[model samples]
Target: MHHILFFGDSLTAGYGLKNAKTESLPALVQQKIDADKLPYHVINGGLSGDTSAGGLFRLDYWLNRPIHVFVLELGINDIIRGISPQTTYKNLQAIIDQVKQKYPTVKLALMGMEIPAFVPGSFAAEFRTIFRKLADANQMAFVPFYLAGVAGKPHLNLPDMLHPSAEGYRIIADNVWPVLHGLL
Candidate 1:
């Protein structure tokens, strides 16, 4: 079976959701795929609080199987933790490189995240450019901003303002569906 792996941090992991298995982004995507009778299995490779560095370290474990589509959604935690944008970029690039090496035919999709306005303007801009740069370099599908419509909207996010609520995830799923659908 072909697999579509949603690899990322808490946002992709559905951190604040009460029913992650059914409400997480990946699960929601799977539901759509199933409705359309697509032959694909959705795997959630999200780890809460994980950074780009952490993702790089754990990538091998998730690479053991054949992956048809790889949806990369990391780097937010690194940005939030005040990690250097260069380091995050390098780690993310390495992860993409490794995935390509292991699964040459895998279709790639990058989910971009934005740093809050509180972050330094230069750093935030640099961080924002990384995902698009990577996507362009690799000729992969890209989502300009993963939290475009959901971020900063209290009704769409949990109390902490970081993680998305179930309703928010639904919005995310809607945003991601078109990108993934084209790949499928």
Candidate 2:
């Protein structure tokens, strides 16, 4: 079976959800794989409030597995915490490097995320550019924005408006499925 690893923050982690099996993005993707009868194993490596630095720290554990495809989604918390964009960018690069070294033939899929509108224009613009730059430099498959239509949509979010509801995770799975399927 194909082993696919998903690493990210609360959104990918399905934060606030009582059951990860029913609510998390990896869970939703796994359900799709089963329903479609695809040959794959989906692993969730999300960490709540995890920055790229945290991802860096846990890289060894996840990368040690025989991962065929890796979905990287991080940096939101860093941006929210007002950490330097350059720092976020560097850490992401480090992740890419480590993954490449360990899994030379692995497929990389980047899950992009946008900064909230309330953030200042300059920072938001730069933050948005970070993913694009990384994808370009690493030659990885890019999802543009993970929460495309669901970001500001209240109906799709939980009470905190930060994480997605079950329905919302379906949308994310739908959006990510094609690219992930293509890669595998």
Candidate 3:
């Protein structure tokens, strides 16, 4: 069976959800696949507060099985932690390289994140460019901003105002589906 791996941080993990299995972006995408009668299984590889380095460190474990489509959504934690954008880029590149090296034909998608407006514009710009640059360089599908419709909307986000709520995740799934469908 084909597997679509949603690999990233809490955003992809459906953080604060009462039922992540059914409420997460991966699961929502899986539902779409099911409705369309597609033969694919969605796997959520999200870890709360995970950085690009952490993703690289744990990638090997997930690579054991065939990954038909890889939706990469890391680096937000790196930005939040004030990690250098250069290091974040390098770690993300390493992760992408490892995936391609292991599964040459797997379809890849890069999900971009945006830092809060409070962050310095220059730093945020550099951070935001990482995903697009990686996607362009690697020839992967790119989602410009993962939190497009959900970010900064009080109703869409949880009390923390960072992670999405269940409805917010649904909107996120919507934002992701078109890109993922094109890849499929």
Candidate 4:
């Protein structure tokens, strides 16, 4: 059986939403696995507004599990808070390095986050580059942007416009599932 662990922030947490366990991407991915009769387990390790630094602080707790797949979906909060991109890059690298040291065979997936034009276009270029660089450096699978189709789409987001609605979650699962399935 494959054990997939989702380590992310509000986007993965399904913040300000209901039936999160059933409506979030992690849950949707779980359902897909079940329908396909794939032997797998999905664990939600998301904490709302968690930055890459925060994820590193809690890495030991989640890394304790025998994870076959580890999905890293952080850095958005840090970007929003105007934190340095270098700090974000370092934190992510640390997590990836530690995971590799302990679980050399574990499949690693890095989910990128795009800084919306409205938020500030200056850092978007560098922010987007971080994911690709890390993926290349660590030889891990990479998702271009976690909120690709869901971001900036009013219909797909909740009232807050920050978090995705259930439909949006499906979009996330759609982009993520294929990559994960291939690994499985």
**Which run of 10 residues does model 1 get worst, by summed lDDT?**
113-122
Compared with the true structure, model 3 gives a TM-score of: 0.97
Of the candidates numbered 1 and 2, which has the greater TM-score value?
Answer: 1
Clashing pairs in 3: none
Error of 4 at 2 (Å): 2.4
RMSD of each: 1.0, 1.2, 1.0, 1.4
C-alpha local distance difference test of each model:
0.92, 0.90, 0.92, 0.88
**lDDT for predicted candidate 4 compared with the true structure:** 0.88
Candidate 1 off by > 4 Å: none
Tens-place lDDT digits, model 1, residues 12-131:
888979999999999999999999999999999999999999999999999998899999999989977999889998999999999999989999999988776687678888987888
Q: Model 1 scores what on Cα lDDT?
A: 0.92
- The alpha-carbon lDDT assigned to residue 68 of candidate 2 equals 91
TM-score winner between candidates 2 and 3:
3
Compute each candidate's TM-score over C-alphas.
0.97, 0.95, 0.97, 0.95
Task: Kindly give the number of clashing pairs for every candidate.
Answer: 0, 0, 0, 0
Error of 3 at 44 (Å): 0.7
lDDT of 3 by residue, 11-86 (tens): 9899999999999999999999999999999999999989999999999999999999999999889988999889
